[model samples]
Target: MASDSYDFIIVGGGTAGLAVAARLSEDPSQRVLVLEAGHDAHSDPRIKTPASWLSLLGTDVDWNFRSEPQPLLDDRVISLNQGKVLGGSSATNAQVFVPPATAVVDHWENTLGNASWNWETLRPYFAKAYTSPPVDGTMAETLGIDGWTETSTTHGPVRTAFPGDQSHPIRKIWADTFRATGHYMAKDPFVGSTVGSFTALASVDPATGERSHSAAAYYYPIKTRENLHVITNATVEKVSLNRHGLNHVTAKATGVLYHCGDEIKEVTCEKEVILAAGALQSPKILELSGIGNADLLRQHEIDPIIDLPGVGENLYDHIMCSISFAAVDELETLDAIFRQEPDALEDAAKRYAKDGSGPFSSMGVYSYAYLPVLKHASPEGRQKLIELLEEARPTKGDTPEHARAQAYYEIAKASLLDPKQPSCAYLAFIAQFVGAFESNTKSFTISAMHSQPLSRGSVHIQSKSVATAPKLDPKYLSNPLDLEIFAANLLQIETIIRTSPLSTLIKQPIVHRDPASNLTDLDSAKNWIRKNGDSMWHYGGSCAMLAREMNGVVDEKLKVYGVENLRVVDASAIPIISTANIQATVYAFAERAADLIKESHGLKAAGA
Candidate 1:
């Protein structure tokens, strides 16, 4: 018998868990319990200010999990920074608002068993999760007001702009020059299309200056709700289940076993148990519950209740690399200026605190472009990505039907990228990508991001012990084709920097590091990038949603397989990686999952 129990027990009080709790608790009747492995929310200055938040890295709030050494890139140990606190990565991420592409939604409908996941159906949830700040005259017409995550670019007094010359003598030059060169502007990066540069950002309120996180934007508003119990510093060890009579494999879940500091406790759930522990940890929780890969579990001396083989496979991430240039002068750049003049940093901080407008606005990462690397990519690159997706699709079997699926994918690709359409620069940083630039006379920086590469990896249970960290491999740039395309993309970026518009302002040349030894090279900078690239800190796709018996831990409805009442609602539920920042999309997933949970129970809507 359990000492205590609730209607739903949610594990991991980070971005997804909190969102689930917040949405379900709307009724004030249904009880939801959230367990966090980290500390209670704090008023730390570093967390409150967006610019200074980077200082939180490697601190108590960060999970700071380093991956096993990469066999490809000089065996470098990649650092995977996950949020250890209530807000999860949202508290630690740069707060970029790149929404999932519409085509991604279509793909979800086709892959996942539920067709209700299409863009039109999911759009409302996306709108409800955010609250957008007011945009100025010209920008107002461009941005979306319907989003639920509450994004705003209306800079407040204390919020600082990206640290460079907005009026750079070259910004207008580049914008006009790019237009003349025939590049089209992508309207809103989160909606319908994403292929051009538009003004980018989620501006914080000047009156508050503090960045709004999941805790603030979603959970804090309903923190005092009587039905919601949020437990921090409580690590869920495993979920406990009770078997129904023989042959009824769909057993009833009674409760979950978790650790509070060193004490083990069981909290039963009357209705359901949600593993909202994000991508990497969610599958691990299911495995701990004895609900995955039977052979692997038997080896670990644990009884296997479920035979799901896809518990901890299909991991993927975007790896980023960049060119760092020598700044011409201290005043013209943010890093150098702040370093050279302590007063400037102090002044910026003071303004943000006093007025919320200074240098605290999202560090200038606006401007972006999605360029395709493969123009009829080779059969090799498609093999890994296609095989994984096929394994997750439910069209019958690996029979003739499955083989025909390849044609559909090619058609989708041709529709999106028309080669006959004159080849424009396949690289860009105009909106939402370059982030705040330093002063004109200082250092120059341009980053290259892998938008939607065909590389997949994995995160698996190394041991059954709760104290051991799960083994993670991002498999970054694993495919030779991905390497070739990404390398070529790097060269394009180098071309823009070396061209007339940007070259005139260039101080020192950008050095490329060798992939094998991490050494710099004057020639073949592209080669170095392929060999030495690392993640952009975006980690997900583990325990992804798909049809049952189709290599999925969760259903299209986000419910876990073989478990009577378990669901995963976070970045981990994403079947395929989105082409942008994942925070906003995760919030949307939470919002929708909450409604689904409510509907499943035949419960009245929260407000109702």
Candidate 2:
């Protein structure tokens, strides 16, 4: 049985939850409790080994939630994978540690009307969240990693390192190919603007070659602290709130009701209850607590506490589709080592066990390119995209909640179409074929990911039961503009494959489409996307942080509107998805949120 009370009870012991818990527990007087739905994965080999990430996809460590059949994709149900372990998706995701573009952060500040949320104010937290190793001789100085260490009282918990010296020969070829095709080579992608092609860093320690996630970096370091308590395998049912007399509009969360093993329990918090569950589950928790649409709550036989309809409305995620090619016999992919050669695999494992430097230590993705639509789209293609954006407006019957989502889509479309904006399309090259590794063939994949999507979806509780999964409708490629952008980006990827250095090593296309067939026709490319596209697993915006008039679930400070002592500090509060991977941004957001909470409670802030 866990303790009956604490100062702060954080629901969901994932990436954001652990970061907030670590910071809040810095003051020994504050009693902090974190409830995790999954067990502690400290010794799990599948999670510790970077190359073993794919094996954990359908296992118990994964939430393995499936999206509702997407209408745009011939009603195919796409898999939505999220980490259920202590570190959340950070423990399960590819260890790419890239930050968002400056423009994306600027959008959160200007569009959300929060002057303090810009990149400049949040820049310090990015430095505070991770301790980065030098990429090259001068990189530590250029990125100010040394400066951050010298100035700050406490060094960051998470460790960031390069992909090691043994990068595959194909990596350089891909980088050179992008430069030859007229894309600027990014000097360092971590310095705010990620506009060009560059080598990506991962969240791994170079010395030990083990995965560096929130659990290993943040929670475990302070687990023995008397004020910090963590409950594993506990599922939070609902947040228990106390309402003011006769005023349903005002309420304060006092405790949480959850189930641990065979017993149901209740834990009270004297100060606050923070919801750090990811996008899908966070909104479902709110709806279960009667804080969503009044009609939806009444339908579930739960009394409405707040009539905020934006609780689960504005859903956004990156959509990705891959174009795979068979690799030449001279080139060795990760798949070839495991499938063909047994003794070599044993030797590699021995090497990793002895020194932690081998194929098993890396994620196999070395270089990536971010391209704006203007870089690839023709004049006619650009005009077509504008027309598509203009036609994609809110319907007259859309509710206030949905209208707010439509307004955000307009802003996103404008940013994507703006030539000056950093990028809307991401092209990533993996050294191995992702889904078809079981086949007895050596292959590599080029995944074209659309960063800025206009389509919106929702995740709502179908019943008043936390045991049941929520209905998730990502509505991928629902907007014609998304398909249009994907088609243009696919052409750009093919151009890179056809360019000099990479083309010499390339073979025929394996899965997506015939390499010989010309995809110049827009409709043919769009059809191909509908059949092959899926989510990139970067989900957010179900509980966005915007003004109440914009149908926001939480305010700028991450406090849930109309409710006191209740806040959501996770990816769910992100209004717009960032241009790069979201884990770094999530960490930064948690770091800043901890400061805000400390200020409100009159507690001394961490790193003050």
Best by lDDT: 2
Q: Write the per-residue lDDT of candidate 2 for residues 471-556, one digit (tens) a residue.
A: 99998877766787777777666666777777766665423334532456667667767877788888899999888888889988
Write one digit per residue (lDDT tens) for candidate 1, span 174-265.
Answer: 44434444443424444454344344444243346566677776677678888888888988888887666567566557789998877989
TM-score of 1: 0.83
How many Å off is the CA of 112 in candidate 2?
3.1
Query: Each model's TM-score, in the order given?
Result: 0.83, 0.92
Error at 65, model 1, angstroms: 0.6
The CA lDDT of each predicted structure is: 0.63, 0.78
Point out where model 1 deviates above 4 Å. 1-3, 111-114, 138-177, 245-248, 326-332, 337-341, 373-441, 498-526
* Alpha carbon lDDT at 2, candidate 2: 49
lDDT of 1 at 119: 76
